[model samples]
Structures are given as structure tokens and as C-alpha cells.
Target: MTKGIQNSETPLFLLSMMMENPEAAELCFPQLLNNSCRKPLPPQSDGMLVYIVLSFISLLTVTLNLLVIISISNFRQLHNPTNLLILSLAVSDFLVGLLLMPAEILHTEACWFFGDHMCALNYVVDFIITSSSVGNMVLISIDRYLAICDPLQYTNKVTLDRTKICVCLCWICSVLYNSLILNNFLRHPDEQNSCYGECVVILNNITGTVDFVFTFISPITVIIFLYARVFVVAVSQARTMRSHIATVALQRSVKVTAKKSEMKAARTLGVVVVVFLICICPYYSPTLVGQDIEDSSSSSPFVVWLLYFNSCLNPVIYAFFYPWFRKSIKLIVTLQILQPDSCNAGIM
Candidate 1:
């Protein structure tokens, strides 16, 4: 009788200890005992809700970006220097949907099961995608600036071949820049880690500041300045065109047609830039506050998701603004793309 009571009490004590000590209660590697990180254990209901919502977002991002890729790549009419930049941006966004979003979901809700090397590689990839996306936006802004602010010079200056080269250089520079920035972390992923299950990379203050300026401040400044100039010129042109409407009828009509086309393109690309800024600003809020930029754990998941969600939104913008995108989607959905000479089909 005494022995049975003792055994019952022992089990109860162990259970109570496990319940009290959160770290011991849930571990990523139970066998490691003291070495492993505690696994995050939010309430089951909250966890389920987050997973369902984020998974849906990830799926939507993938689908939307895939459609953009198909639309721009398949239509010969859509092939131009400006569309090439859009294609580059879409590819970066597609990769974010494909690789980064899912990985982020797992990082937020669970433990790092893929080990340290993978963690380093993941960070490297993330940086590359981010940098490339920013570069493409800069290129898009410059393309619009030249088209709107200097219509005659635009044709000679921005050709398809030159745009293609610029796109290639953008990607290559992103890779090289991120590789240099993340070299230390990539070399020693576990150097700063306190436990087995968490994956984190930290940059020193100087490096963080430099990255913040180049990645966030400089690009944003350029974008805003170029767009501001474009706006002023656009308004001035509108006023001039209205005033001279009666004087230069035939010649003005010809020039007005071209100007209208450029203005429309400028307006659409402006929307894209505005949306990009909205999504990205939150992700960099920490840096703005002088905090070290730690992407995996220290950053808010909502901000991170918002940034990733921007990729998903770009194609939706295109669909709403560009009739060609809608028509291409219909063609793609009906499996008409598989037909011969479909690329020559009138999309624009």
C-alpha cells in the first residue's frame, strides 16, 4: 500500500515539474537535454489559425506570380524593355513565394530542423532575392523617368538589349553583394547561437548601418526623387498641351498620342513603386530605430509577411491595370498556351 502511494506521487511530481518548466516541457531535441532550444508552443487554436492563413497566402503568392511569368513570357506583343524589367521583378517575387514564404512559415511556428548550414544558405538566398527585387525597382523607376521626362532620348537610350544586360548585371551584383555581406555568418552559422534548434544571424552595428543606407535609404531616395521629377514634368506637360491645343493641331496630335502612351505607362509603374514602398517600409522599421537587423526571430512576423506579401500583390496590380494580363490569364487557364504559334497571339 505504501509503495503504491509513493509510485503515484512520483508520477504526479514529474508531471508537475514538466508543466512548470517551459523549456523542459517542450524541446526541439529532447535527447540533447541542456543543448537544445525550447520549441515554441503557442496555444493550439492560435497556431492553427496562423498556419491556415499564412499557408493560404503562400499559395496565392505562388499562383499569382506564376501567372505573371506566363503572361509576360508567352506573349510576343508584351516583349519590350519595360516588360522585361517587369519579368525580372516577377521572377524575384515568384522565388519569394516559392522558397522564402514557406520557410518563413516554418521558422515562425516551429523549430529549425534543417541544421545550421541550411540556415546560412537560407539567409543568403533571402538577401539575394531582396536585393534583386530592390534593384529591379530602381531600374523600373529609371526606365519610367527617361520615358516620361525625356521622350526623344528614351528610344535611343533604353533598348531591349541594353535592358536585358542591365537585368543580368542587377542579379549578378545582388549575388555578389549579399555573398560579401553574409560571408561571416555563412562561414560560422553556429557562432552566435545559444542552443541547437534556433537559427539566427546577426550583423554588427557598422555593417548593419551600411546595409541600411544602401539597401533602404539610398534606393528609396532615388525612387522618390525620380518620381517627384516625373510628377512635376507630367503636370507641366498637361498644362502646356491644353494651352497649345488649338495652335498645333496635326503635329500636336501625333506628339500627344506618344505622350499619352508614356504618361499611362508612368502612372502604372508609379502604382507599383508605391505598393513596393508600403510593404517594405515595415520590414526595415527595426533598422530605422537603430536596432540590429535580425530577420529570423527578432523581427516581427507581421512585418516580414507584409514584405513577402508584396510579391503576391504586384501581379494583382498588373491584372487590374493591364488588360493584356487579364487576357493572357484566360489563355493560360484554358490551356491554349500549348498551341503552336500561341506566342504570336494578340495579347496587347
Candidate 2:
């Protein structure tokens, strides 16, 4: 329907053909037709290098996030409502790095070896996790916004039960939104084509645009808006703090330490927001401009590495930017070191 496929010689008709016949493409396309293949494959050396680096980064990121998640979940002190949202986001990112990236690396090695069921499931899982991450980010923004703008009301409104319900709803909505792919377009299978066998349906251009808009563009907009508001609030607080410091400077007896504590909190929160935007924007922005343009764009190793870098940065961000999280990590490390001594004393 779009101008791209208007009169093309090798039209991308596989998606359309699969919609009409459930098992047509798979039955027709040969699995290993030597020399008859239309496109040339990448060199083994370069592809292997990509696989190795991506695999390493992905594994490292997942392990670190898992540790963060475990640390928070295990410790009673880390169970605050705000921290709960952070834990949710970490879990989602970890799953993306752990379960999804390796499978993607494998798919790049050969073809889509997993088949239709696995492919569909893969898409579903990635969709859910990515969506939830975005949703959790938005929720976190709102959480911070409220804490800044309406601390009193926030304490009353943001209860543990409400937070749990909100997370569950976010997951449900994501699943429903992604299920449209399976329900409408992905059902038709073309076994004739080797790659098309596990093909997920691409909706028409209008619907596809809507999907991209909702999934990527809209969330980014919301996050940017929240970030803007948060920045304004932070700037206002800093000015107020400066005014108080000036006033308190005259009072020799009242050495106000609260100003320093407030400034530290603001700095930590600011870093968290900035890092979240930086890491996530690269991954989501490319997916938003549409995948067609992405394919044609000159492949850069830096961009590829940056995509994986998003996952790798979360643990470091938490360790550096969040006071409570840093404290938790230190406590964990200290506990590990001290456990041996405690056991030795017990034996003696």
C-alpha cells in the first residue's frame, strides 16, 4: 500500500502473502537452496566478532542487574514504594538482556532456527519487557514528581497496594497491545520461505505507525515532559536553599546542615533522571524512526555497542547515583567479607 512497495521488482510481499494463507510461505521457501539465494551473507569473521562482544556485554549486564535486584529484594530496608518501582525496572531490563539478547545473537549467527512458535513467543516476551520498562520509567517519573511537588499527598496516595496494582496493570496493557500482532497478522504462515517460516506480521503502514507511536514516541514524550517538570522543581528548590543559606549565614549559632543534605538528594535524583534518559533514548529512538531506515543506515560498531551499553550502564548508574542503593551494595560486600570471620568465631 505504501509508495515503497508500489512497483518494486522484489516487493516485500511475504508479510501480505502470509496473512492470506496460514502455512503457505513455509511450505514453499527452501531451507537451504545453494547459489539460488538472492542476498549475500556477511563474512564469518565479522559476524563472529559481533556475536562474541554482544554476548559478553549482554551477559555481564544481566548478571549485574540480577545482583541489584536480588540485593534489593533480599533486604527489608530497600522495600520502599519508590525502590519497588526501581526493582521492577531492573527486573525488566535484566530479562531483556538475559533472555532476549542471547536469542537475538543466535538468530544472527544462522537463520531463525527457533521456528514459528518460538519466534512469536520471542516477540511477545520482548514486547512485554520493553513496554513494562517504559511504563515503569513513567511511573518512576510520576513518583519523583509527586515527591517533589506534593510530598504530603504523595505519602497518602502512593500506598504499597496501589503500586502493585499499577505494575500489574502496566503488564496487562502491554500484553494486550502486543497481542494484536499475533491475533491479526502473525497467524498466517508461509513455510515456503526459509526466513518467512517464523515471520511475525507487520501491520499496514497506518497501523504500524500507530503501534510505533504508542510504543516508542508517546512514552518518550511523557518521559521528557516529566523530566522537564522535575528539572524545574529541582531548580526552584536549589534557589530556595540558597536563599535559606544566605539567611542562616547571619545566625552564628544555627549551623544549618539540612541544606547540604537537600543538595545531595537533588544531585542524586538528577543523575538518575539524566542517566535513564541517556541509556534508553538510543535503544528506543532507532526503533521509532522505523526499522526500514535503520537497515539502510550505515552500520556503525559504535551504535551497535551503544545499544548493548544501555543494559551495562544500569548497575553502575545505581551504584553511583543512588545513595541508598550504594549503601546497600556496600553493606552486601561488607557482609560477604565479614561472614567468614563470623563463622570462624562461631567455630571457636
Candidate 2 residue lDDT tens string, 268-326: 55565566667656654544555521211123445434544665687777777666666
Model 2 alpha-carbon miss at residue 343, Å: 18
Judged by TM-score, which candidate is best? 1
Q: Tens digits of per-residue lDDT for model 1 on 140-207?
A: 99998998887767889999999999999999999999999998888788887778888888877877
**What local lDDT does model 2 show for residue 40?**
29
Each prediction's total of clashing residue pairs, residues at least 3 apart in sequence or on different chains, is 0, 12
Ten consecutive residues with minimal summed lDDT in candidate 1?
A: 1-10
Best by lDDT: 1
lDDT of 1: 0.86
Question: What does the lDDT read for residue 148 in candidate 2?
Answer: 62
